[model samples]
Target: MSEGRPRLNTEMVRLGGLIKQAEQALITAKTIALKQFDLTVPQYAALFVLGTTPEASAAQLARACLVTPQTMATVITNLEAKGLVDRSTSPMHRRLRETRLTDTAIPVLEGADRAAVQIEEALAVEFSPEELRSLQELLNRTITALHQLG
Candidate 1:
């Protein structure tokens, strides 16, 4: 389509296709480790976010997890039901619920984290460190570029 650039089918060679397939693969593999603890991806996500930001409210965690507040409500409910997270009325804001991980949840989350690391390690086995670093740098640039476009 361009005057002098190499032409290719956009649909067949776009970033979205690659990104989506990679996500699906990772999710399928991750779901198994999480299932062993009776958790879903969103539930595990809630625990990880709460552990890092204990003061965050459900709304805040929802935004961080890239889900709507309504969907996150379900995630919080499941995590609470499993005793993995403790939700308290926010002292600073009566309408908000501040959430955090329970002591018993740490080991489960750690196991899930280990499982994720193993998946990433296995996926990276074919790549050299330099190649991986270059890919990361390029992906970072692409993300920044897309954000600027938006």
Candidate 2:
């Protein structure tokens, strides 16, 4: 439609297709790993976030996961039911409850980490080290841009 520039439909279409493929690949990997633990994707996400940032509150976890507080509350409740996380009142703020990994959760999180590493290895097998680094850099930039837009 531009006066002189050629339309980039092919490039746009290829990028869209690659994005869709990558999204499905991620979902498939997570789904397979989650089946063993009887955990939903969001539940695993909460566990991983709590593992990385111990003693994070539901609101804080919500912000980390980009979910609403109510949704994160449900995630927290489910994780609690599984005995994977312990909720405690923050010493600094009695009203604010923080979540920490339980003894049982440590092993579960370790297993999840292994499963994720396997997934990454499988994906990395298709690319050279330099290409993998480039891919990661590009993904980081894209994530930053998308978060800024949001």
Candidate 3:
């Protein structure tokens, strides 16, 4: 090894891989759980966001969901076609469109949310309250550190 070179941390590398694996597993679980509601993970993500931020534009939803604008546009179109969301010209900006959940979507979103909570609940049961809090903090810190790198 070069004298000036730093040693690689195998434990940190393993942790990063585990994080990715866990994320993929969570997405898979969500996909199966949401299937009964005829929604995909991305669709559920959009609805989840819209549930809290009613009348958000596709751009806003895209940002919040961490997806590209084109991807979000497709999601909005699909949701609109399914009658799960309504898009209208923004009152504040006539040229810009905003989207909100329809009455039909409220019940579906509620059901999907319950399904998601079940997955979370199952995971939460494996950890003590204090441990869960610490885990959340660590994950948040990890995310912050990654963002700083970029």
Candidate 4:
């Protein structure tokens, strides 16, 4: 351990492990829920971003979705093939392509959103509103602390 740094304890280690496990569980549940819409988690992430940021570049989508540019490119190609997205030359940057969700994707996203929301609601129901608020604050602080280390 570095000078002035606190030593790790079992509770700290367990907290990290629990966070990872919770994340994996959420992903697995989302994977199963998204299957009916023929969407992968990454695909859903991209669409969810595009829903609010229409005509966004793949690079922008990649950053917003926490994916690499190469991965976003592939996802865009697949979505295009499925008629879920359309790409066009950016008016301001002719060399760049902008992506947007198609009409076909609207209904698919609606259903997927409902399924995802149901999972969130189920989780929220397990905690009191005050507890949920505190958890959210703690998670936000944790994220900020982690980012400060980088």
Model 1 — TM-score against the truth?
0.86
What is the model-wide C-alpha lDDT for candidate 1? 0.84
* Global lDDT scores for all candidate models: 0.84, 0.86, 0.94, 0.92
lDDT order, best first, reads: 3, 4, 2, 1
TM-score of each: 0.86, 0.80, 0.89, 0.89
lDDT of 4 by residue, 113-146 (tens): 8888887888889899999999999999988998
Error of 2 at 55 (Å): 1.2
Report clash pairs, candidate 3: none
Tens-place lDDT digits, model 3, residues 40-89: 98999999999999999999999998899999999999999999999999
Q: How does model 3 score by TM-score?
A: 0.89
Per-residue CA lDDT of candidate 1, range 58-89, in tens?
89989999899999999988888888888889
Q: Kindly indicate the candidate among 2 and 3 with the higher TM-score.
A: 3
lDDT score at residue 107, model 2, on the 0-100 scale: 86
- Top candidate (lDDT): 3
Residue 45 error for model 1, in Å?
1.5
Winner of 2 and 3 under lDDT? 3
**The candidate that achieves the highest TM-score relative to the unseen native structure:** 4
